[model samples]
Target: MTGDEGPSYTVDDALVALGFGKFQILVLVYAGVGWVSEAMEMMLLSFVGPAVQALWNLSPHEESFITSAVFAGMLIGAYSWGVVSDRHGRRKGFLITATVTSIAGFLSAFAPNYILLIALRSVVGIGLGGGPVLSSWFLEFVPAPNRGTWMVIFSAFWTLGTIFEASLAWIVMPNLGWRWLLALSSLPTSFLLLFYKLTPESPRYLCLKGKTADAIEVLEKIARVNGRELPSGNLVSDHEIELQQIDNPSEDARLLSPRTNEIKHPLGMDSNLGGISSLSVLLSPKLARSTVLLWAVFFGNAFSYYGLVLLTTELNGHSKCVSHKLQTEKSQDVSYKSVFIASFAEIPGLLLSAVAVDKLGRKLSMSTMFFICCIFLLPLVFHLSEGLTTGLLFLARICITATFTIVYIYAPEMYPTSVRTTGVGIASSVGRIGGMICPLVAVGLVHGCHQTAAVLLFEIIVLLSGICVMFLPIETMGQELRDSVQV
Candidate 1:
């Protein structure tokens, strides 16, 4: 079996044969670091806003800009990096994102003025934008049966990051200040670059792009690391698989025929299909409905998730049971404590989703979480005791965090390898739009005496998000990763 010949086994077949082991752990650790880095940077926005406001005596609008700038850059980064990973390679995208995030974030600590600080943080956001690619990259290596649980488990690192940021803010911001916090927070991301050499491009991506030999090389490496061997056959190219699909469109085609003269793209189009971008492929008739619904889910999830995060401080501020000394103390201390405490809710949320994601499936797990999250959030619209309000916020955080992780898993699984990152990146970018607007509502309106209206808006959005999840055409739980739209 020469490299040019159609392999007797598929990528999935080889992965199943290898099973999950040490190599998969390595991939998870590497990918998880990216998650941690991105989370810290994002969580930084919540902590830094107030400190900067106190230092510069900036208006509320300016403090809000700090958060919006990052999301704006994220919107741009998510779209661009997705396309980059789809076209160039996932490994390259990972390297670039880590490099950009680490350097830009570190420089943010030394900004001479507020304008420079925002500009630097925006650049950091650009690097942080490729976060969805990590999900796609990690998922491709995992077997279908284990994909949901593993992905949710991987998302736990993100929660760890948020907690770490809160802790770091609590320690540093109260003493060393925001500059020190920024410096310390940005430091961890730089380590990802040092560890980048440990990761390889997605073998599934290599196969779809017709790099069969390179794909095989990666698979073989994985097998070696896992103390196993590839399935006892030549690995199949996506082109060969597509030919079998064409020959018998309704069933799994396993014929190992030689390559044909007519080359084909996975979207059931000719290889020479012109002027079609990955975005266009996603919006094609075959995938358009799923794409739109998934986008809506993404938007709602972001609006509610980030809105609740920003609202934590507001909720804490309204509590009447605070001691007189605490009221007179630095607001940053109280804010960080509330954020730190609320973030713990994500642990149980992640644990629950990890279980439900596999048992109940992705669509059901996500919709259920969104609805439950809405239930917890609704009570906050009315005045309540501080302890009751705190309890409600914690419960709400749990559900929203779970939904956030599940949505990331579901979006990538829905797309073909050719545009997996692109689909995820675009969806994530739409979510950032929600993240951008959330400050205006979560912080702005809440502070402007429209707290009731703001919480009600979040409730409605969360409820609608659940409906969109139900409308999704396919459930990805245990579904084999699709290499092309044709499959």
Candidate 2:
């Protein structure tokens, strides 16, 4: 700890100047594990879907119910946990989600019936729903200069999850069966709780809660770990300054006036200029339009992304569809191999987005990739050869996965710290509506309706999503995150 004799700086200045170091690296490891686990639960249904169908002698509709259950939980979890973290603290939210998800995941494997399985999956989904919080939590600690790149790269961890799921299915789908696969997929989540102990609560979060002394202590720990000295004197933060300014304005002066529609407080209680409430802040004038558009992007992204992911094996062959043991096993083998290969596409996709987001700006990166995804999906619309269709589907997956990464990167950058997690949670919860609908549409449009309808829907949705990206007004390339939502 160096002497507290240097320049008097706000916490933001101290943090930005310290730059990226051990703290960022630790976040990747700690949060990265959570990311991988969340990815696994999201992908688990896709991997286990076919197996569940065969074991329980079920219809595609029931299969969809199981897949969507987790997303339903996630929708609720994202909203509830976002509020928990904002009002209580980030650390509490983090630990609670990890613990609940882990226990639910492990126990879900033992469910005896299809109804029980989906029910348990819903619990797992709720825990997974809190996943967006990890990104916002980690983002506050990172420097803005490389923040977009780091976010894209962080999303790349999803590839490892894809690898884990496909590889697990390849090995166990034959001998161990779907029950064992579910068990194996969830077993690793216990490690996330252990990792939780290693992460410090976000200093920004502490500052927001008015625990200034605790916030400074965490910052010093981060500085020490980074081999840097703290800039001295009473370390201040923008939040503290805002509180002071709002809490103590001059007599007969209302510097932080409420908007036209807001209620005026007697005895000066409007100091909570957090704009009505946490959720209301995003709906405030400066942020409302961006919030709606961003939610549109999230909805389109999940609708297509998970629609493809949860049905990858099913779309490939009748292995999980047919009842003949020998044929079902053989077809499943082929589907698993194909899923493994296509998953490799995600690695390159993440790398491309990591570089593209930095070079192309967010809107262009998302728009270009989404357009390409629609182009690739056109082959499926034409009902091409299996060989040609499979190849195109992989290409489409790469593009959509890349687009997904950019959306996550773009959302956090769009909202400020005051409502970062809230904005993300609301957007994600809306996206999960698409996720919930994905299974029903993916299966119904194919088996119940026609494959052509499903392909056209996917193509149309991806194209529309790309168009939405192009319409966004701002492009957060290397902009710093502020304490207030500034549109």
Candidate 3:
């Protein structure tokens, strides 16, 4: 028997029994670096675009392209990295993909022309694709009881990262220039790589890959790191054995679920799917309905959130205080300071999500945020006092941003471990399409004097998204995970 036919249960049981531990905390801390790095770069454009535009004398269309270029590359990266990490290992994605992204982010600082900057930012985006899975990797290792809470807390880093970028830009952008800001954006890559260097691959991943011995070894490390001893018994899992079956190599040699661990042709002949599709599993009778709804939720979440958040640079201009920052003899960094305050709204939103997710269940809490986000956006369809309008914007930011963490933490919980990342990747790519759409459409509309239409559209789409959440069939709140489950 090959590793596939070895002991059915190995590391998962040990991890579950170990409970929540410090090792999981360590993973969250490391994963936050990638979150910060990518968050900084994604938001970097709002700061950099003005500088690039001033430098190159770019038109509105040209400036929009700069943002689109990154999402275009992100579309490919998010999907591919998820699949690759599932096929190879999450550690490789953290190391190889993030390093490549950091370098691209850093190199954009030196681009000679707008064309080169766009190309470099695209490269930065492709690398950024691998960054989101840091949450999935963390969730896979942590105990199930508190997984939702931790993942929500983890998303706070996205908020913190944005705060860092804004605060740093406020300090340095006036003197050091946008080039320096871009350079600093890439710095987290090296730190993220170093952090993962001391980390182990997910033990659940090792078992699925049939690396029973390796999986156990990692669990021993987890137990030790968590300040506990491995239970004195077979680490093999009874639950996994009940959930998994040996597939006939000739009939279905590859796993089509994003979990992709269903069957292994470790020697390579039957390893990759030849005829089946990973997405096909998500569309199966058992999952098809939920998958469609899930996609809608993901699409709506991404569309409404990024669509609005990205336009902050332009939107902030309409505020009296922000307008003063731009028009007055105020400190040059005042604009940056305003940006920091707007993005800082995400902090309290995440904290609220962390507690609400457990207290209200993922469904109620997430859907509520989605609808609440819509309510906040409604007043923006018409004129209001500048302060009120900005406050409304910040309020919307809190709701949509909270929705992001909630959906992200919830999606993987719905899937078996085998396909969790794949599910997330696909959903995220769909979301990126939203991210791609909003900037192209909304930015131009804001420029063309159709700001009301833009606000209405964002509100309508998100309202539908919240409705989708209400229809979701599964609720993972306070649920234990399934490390493996049969077809």
Query: Residue-wise lDDT of candidate 2 within 374-469, one digit each (tens)?
Result: 878876755555566567778888898899999998998888666777688889999999999989987756655366777788888888888888
TM-scores for all predictions: 0.92, 0.89, 0.88
Q: Model 1: per-residue lDDT, tens digit, 1-487?
A: 3233443888888888899889999999989988998889998888888778767877768888899999999999999888888888899888899899989998999998899999998999899999988888999999877788789889999999999998888888878888988888888777778888877989988887778899999999999999998877777755566576566544223334322223344572233222247778889877999999999999999988888888888667644423243462445566888888988988998998898998999999999999998899888888676567778989998999999999988998898787888889999999999999998888777656677898899999999999999999988787787776752
lDDT of 3 by residue, 1-487 (tens): 1135443334555666787888888888888777888888877777787677667877767878888888888877877877776677778856777878978888999999988899999988788877657777888887777788788878888898888888888877888899999998789878976666698888776676667688788888888888887755444542334333333333232443233453332211112422135577667665677778988998898788777665565655543223232352243344465577788889878987987998999999989998888888898877666466668878988998888989988888887555666667777777878877888666677766677888888988999999999999989887766544444
Candidates sorted by TM-score, best first: 1, 2, 3
Q: Which runs in model 1 stand beyond 4 Å of their true positions?
A: 1-7, 248-265, 268-276, 318-330
Among these predictions, the greatest lDDT belongs to: 1
**TM-score (C-alpha, index-matched) for candidate 1:** 0.92
RMSD, every candidate, angstroms: 3.8, 4.9, 5.7
What are the per-model numbers of colliding residue pairs?
3, 1, 4
What are the Cα lDDT values of the candidates?
Answer: 0.83, 0.77, 0.74
Question: Which stretches of model 2 miss by more than 4 angstroms?
Answer: 1-7, 240-276, 318-329
Which candidate, 1 or 3, has the higher TM-score?
1
